[model samples]
Target chain A: MKILVCIKQVPDMESRFKANSQGVWFEETDLAFRMNEYDEYAVEQAVQLKEQLGDAPEVTVLSIGPDRVVEAIKKALAMGCDRGVHVQDPAAATRDPWQIASIIASHAGDKGYDLILTGMQSQDRGSAQVGVTVAEELGYACATTLVGFAFSDGTVTAKRELEGGIKGVVRLRTPALVTCQLGLNVPRYPTLPNIMKAKKKEIQTIAVAELLKEEPLATTVSFHPPARKGGGIVLEGDVGVLVDQLLGILKDKTAVLR
Target chain B: MKALLIGEYRQGKLLDSTFELFGFAAQLGGETAFLLVGDETRLPACDGPLYLAEAAECGEYNPDLHKQLILQAVARENPDFIVFVHSSYGWDLAPRVAARLKAAQVSEVIGLTDGGFEVGCCNAKMRRTVKPSTARAVLTIQAGAFPARQPNGTPRIQRLAATGNGGLEFVGYEPAEAKDVDLTRAEVIVSAGRGVGKKENVPVIAALARALGGELGASRPVVDAGWIEHSHQVGTTGQTVSPRLYVACGISGAIQHLAGMKKSDFIVAINKDKDAPIGEIADVLVVADVMQFVPALTARLQR
Candidate 1:
């Protein structure tokens, strides 16, 4: 069996973000980057499935970005993927989800992979659209926000998390796609030895232009920090006094309690 | 402009969020229509052309079958905008429909501006206005972002037939396991986030909740860390609660988490970082260590 896992490198969630000079996306120079938290679960799942299949399956990890994305692919390799593919596109950050998904579908359409995995959404765009678009582009069965996954006899059973804490169960035949969500599994840290080994692994680089099949349908008109509403009063002084004041306000004004 | 609102049906009925699309349609100033893969029983009472693909014919939510119906509806209606409620169903199907239509697609729209649709970016610390270059576009509005427009007249029903067989099988839904805790019903919610330190420290926040005669809630990080059960999660992916009073302890207020609880009557946030986004919406921002302050607050309340 063959499997493909798509990973994205996102700026750390806690970083101070600013719009780039182009006013299209966050400035990249000052931000620290790492594999998206959700995609880490996808890579971990792919690696686990390979291990479960006992050396029978080959896992290929793919990423799209400037050269920095090679690091993300390496992390997936360190976590036990067989190889890496990097679609080099300096303008990757500016491309909409449709353009990105079309690039991926065009590249992976004929790869003959039985299963494809991706994070539910990127930490940056958080659109949660690429995997499903890729599935539609490739005409594969698709499921999103998956927390549990099991595979046997050319079929996949995926557990999807819906709103209001409900779980939907779905079964899909092979040549399917699933998006990994948080709590799917604990992503493993790459051991020192594995990191060194992963450095030696082959990463095939392809210019994104060769795979591009669609223009961006959507474009960001402008980006800025969220507007601040009037600031709230800050409670100060002794902790005990703060509590009393808060309780009194809650009781007298909001009437949440007596 | 003409817009098609993709209605969602699940758990045996039409979702209430479906009506909010009409509100968005009104904002966009367009002639609106509706489409649903379920039968007439799930149709919304609205004044528009409603396209119905009965489950008996189309097998609702079978991606290919539903996509075919939507494509047919679009071909006939020629809508400029396709709107969906940014729920799980929308998250899955909107992109597929958009890809097939070769149309622009935007997800998680939180607000409408004269320039364009506003969406959260950079982990919700920033916002961006996006506009579609294409004449047609697909959009998924954030849950609860728009008010629901009341239905005054019945829709003109137009039935559609399914024509495709997809590779996925819809399995039964496993409802959230019955937990004694229901955050929605709680009058007060004292929520814990990563700052609670560890699993052992959860009881400290729970103690505060108990002392206040309220229920304990948690942010996505705490729940994802397995420090608390998923049932207690307060976020876009979890439970949306509007308690009378909300106490956010150590929660930095990610956009999704804020969406879940911002409607509370009164909110008090305790975090060491006064500039945390939670402070923006909080009625009172208390800058202090949650570990030290929560225990004292609980002790005072209990006394």
Candidate 2:
């Protein structure tokens, strides 16, 4: 089985985000980029699945971004993927889900991989729609929020998380798509030797135009920061008095009889 | 324009988030129609018409079957927008339906507007360039993000007969249960993260929760460490919560963790690091040792 794991580079979650003067987007100069936190889980899942398959399965890491995204490709390589394919696009930072999904679907179609793994949503875009959109485009069976998986004899069984403490396990045939949820597995930290080995791993760069026949469907209008939260009112008094004050405030704000 | 509210009904009743979607649809300005796919049962006191597609063989959620039913319903009604709750089932069904209908989908939406809906991006802090496309949109509202209102008086309920090519069949079903506590609806939550040291110290936070009549929660690390169940995890990867009060003990408030519970009514963070993101958002930021502070706070609460 050939498995393609799609990864993305995202701004570090800890960094402070600031939009540019034109309000188009965040300034990327100072932001440190890394493999998306959720994608790490997806990559880990792919690596584990390959290990379970006992040397028969070939795992490939595929990413689409600017040249800087090679760092993320290297990270995936250190995680034990057999090869890396980077689709270089300068405008990747501005591409929306439809465009990104189109690029991925086209690449996956040509690669003819049996299974494609993606994070349920990218940490940066968080659209959570790419896997499904790519599935729709390629006409493949897709599953999301998958916490557990098992594969045997060209069949994949996945346990997906549902709302309200419910879970559903479904079985799918080969040539399917699955999005990895966090807590699926702990991603391994690359050892110094592995990092050194990853530096020499072959990374093949392809152009987005060569990957996809379609143009991007969407464009950004503008970006703005979310509204600032109002200053909180601190109630000063004893616990009982504070509880009363809090209840009164809640009643006033929500107008609930309780 | 009329809008269709696609609801996932289990055991003959609509989910709470479905009602919240109805509340949202009413705000979107239209005669809201609800489509329920399940066993043959009429929904009582709905705001608008309820179309019942009963397929006993459609046991578990089959995306193909749902897409066909939803498209047929859409063709019949031709509503401008289709709304669903951003639940697992909705995640499975919405995109397929949207693709079949060629409508734009906006997932994880927190609010709506006159011109378009305000979608919640997963990496809201990062990729600031990509904006939601505003065509006829398929939207899934985040659970608990929108307030549900019970409009006065019973709504008109019109039931439609089940009609479609039902080609999907369920072989069997097995449900997986997580031992973790579900913290999404907890009224009060006390969570600990990696900073809490060993698994032995987790009970300290639990004691604090007990004293305050609240439930114990954890970050992904504590849960992954096997100290607590995945259900008690209050982070993006775990459960999204909006409790009355959330007390974070020893958590640094990673954005992934904050995305799950940042909307709580009152946040109290107790961390050794004064500059932790949790401290920035807390109503009361206590820069004390969690090992020292948790037990002391629990004792005071018990008194």
Candidate 3:
């Protein structure tokens, strides 16, 4: 079976993000970059599925971004993906979900892959819409937040996480979309040998304009930072004094009926 | 312009967020319509035109079936805006409906204005830009992002007939049991995080909660560690709470975690590290060991 996995590069979650003077987003220059936390799980799941097939399944890592994104693709290759497709478009960074999904769909549309995998959502956007939208664009059955999966006889049965501990298990045919959740599997780090081999793997770059002929559907208005919080007062002294102070604060805020 | 508000009801009563959405819709000034899909006995009362999609096995949420039902409603009502709460069901189902209708979606919105809306989005990345906007917008209102409002008296309720396309089938459903204490409505909440050390120390926080007659909550880390259920989690990835008094213990307050409980009336954070982000927002910051403070505070409260 052939598998295609989608990956993205995002600002490290630990970075203290700030807007530049132009009122545009720019991570602190001192910050670091890494593969999105969730996409690692997607790549791990893809590699495991290949192992289950009893042979080296042709795993392709597909990423859409600027030149910097090839680093993320190479990381996936080091994790044992067969090859990489890096769609290089300088303007791709500003593309909305529709445009990004369209580009990915265009590549995977004719690839004749049996299964397509993606992280439930990118760490940066957290929109959680790309995988499902791509599935719709490709007319494939799709499931998100999938925590469990079992494959047999050209059919895939997967368990999805729902609200309040509720789980939904569905069966779908081959050529379906599955977004990997956190607990799906522990992703393997790149070994030195694999890392060296990945450098030799071919990376095919596709331009965004070449891939997407239609104009994007949406435009961002502005980004606003969340309001800053006030400083806190440290309460000292014995437990009785603390309780009295705490209760005093609460009583002023809420009307205690009793 | 009119807007359609979709709500989910269990066992006949409207979910709490439904009332909040209705209040929000009233401010936007539109011909608001409410759509409820469930068993006949479980239909909720609505203030606007109510479209009832009844099925024998509709007690559980089936997205495929819901897509068909919502598509029919969109075609019939053709509202300018489609809104749903950012609940688990809404998050799961709204995108599919939006995709089917080819509508632009904006999830996790905090407020609505006449011109557009102010949303709390992770993708906005703490900066504003006009290149990423879209029309036919579908937005999911974040819990606790807006203040809840009382229902308007005498909302007109019009009953519509049930319709089905029969393309999707309901296999089965397992209802999630309701919790005894609804943290979202609790005025005082005592929350624990990974810093509390082990699952065995949870009772210490519970003891403190008992003293203050408050609910017990958890951050996503503790919830994911299996120390507490996901329902008890407070964060962007978990449930959002807006209590009058929120006590966060040992939580460093990641942006995702802060997004959930930042609306609390008074936040008190107790962590060893003084620089924990929770300390910045907390009204009271206790720089000490949670293990040492929790039990002492519990003792004082019991007195």
Best by DockQ: 1
Once superposed on the true structure, which residue ranges of model 1 sit more than 4 Å away at CA? A234-258, B273-275, B296-303
* Residue-level lDDT for B129 in candidate 2: 31
TM-score of chain B of each: 0.91, 0.69, 0.66
- The fraction of reference interface contacts (C-alpha pairs within 8 A across chains A and B) present in each candidate is 0.84, 0.29, 0.41
lDDT of 2 by residue, A1-258 (tens): 899999999887656667666665667879899999889998988888888888677888989988999999999999888889999998787676777888888888777889999998876567688888888888877778887778888777887766543566777777888888877788999889988888888888999888766544444445555543446443343444444454455456532214
lDDT of 3 by residue, A85-127 (tens): 9999866656777778888888888988888888987766666
Arrange candidates, best TM-score first: 1, 2, 3
Docking class of 1: medium
Model 3, B186-208: lDDT tens digits are 88789998889999999999888
Question: How do the candidates rank by DockQ, highest first?
Answer: 1, 3, 2
**Model 1 CA lDDT for position B41:** 64
Better of 2 and 3 by TM-score: 2
Give the clash count for each candidate: 0, 3, 13
Interface RMSD of each: 2.5, 6.9, 5.8
Between candidates 1 and 3, which one is better according to TM-score? 1
Off by over 4 Å in 2: A215-219, A233-258, B11-13, B40-44, B47-49, B122-135, B150-189, B194-215, B225-227, B234-245, B250-266, B271-282, B285-303
Task: Please name the candidate that would achieve the greatest lDDT relative to the true structure.
Answer: 1
Backbone clash tally for model 1? 0
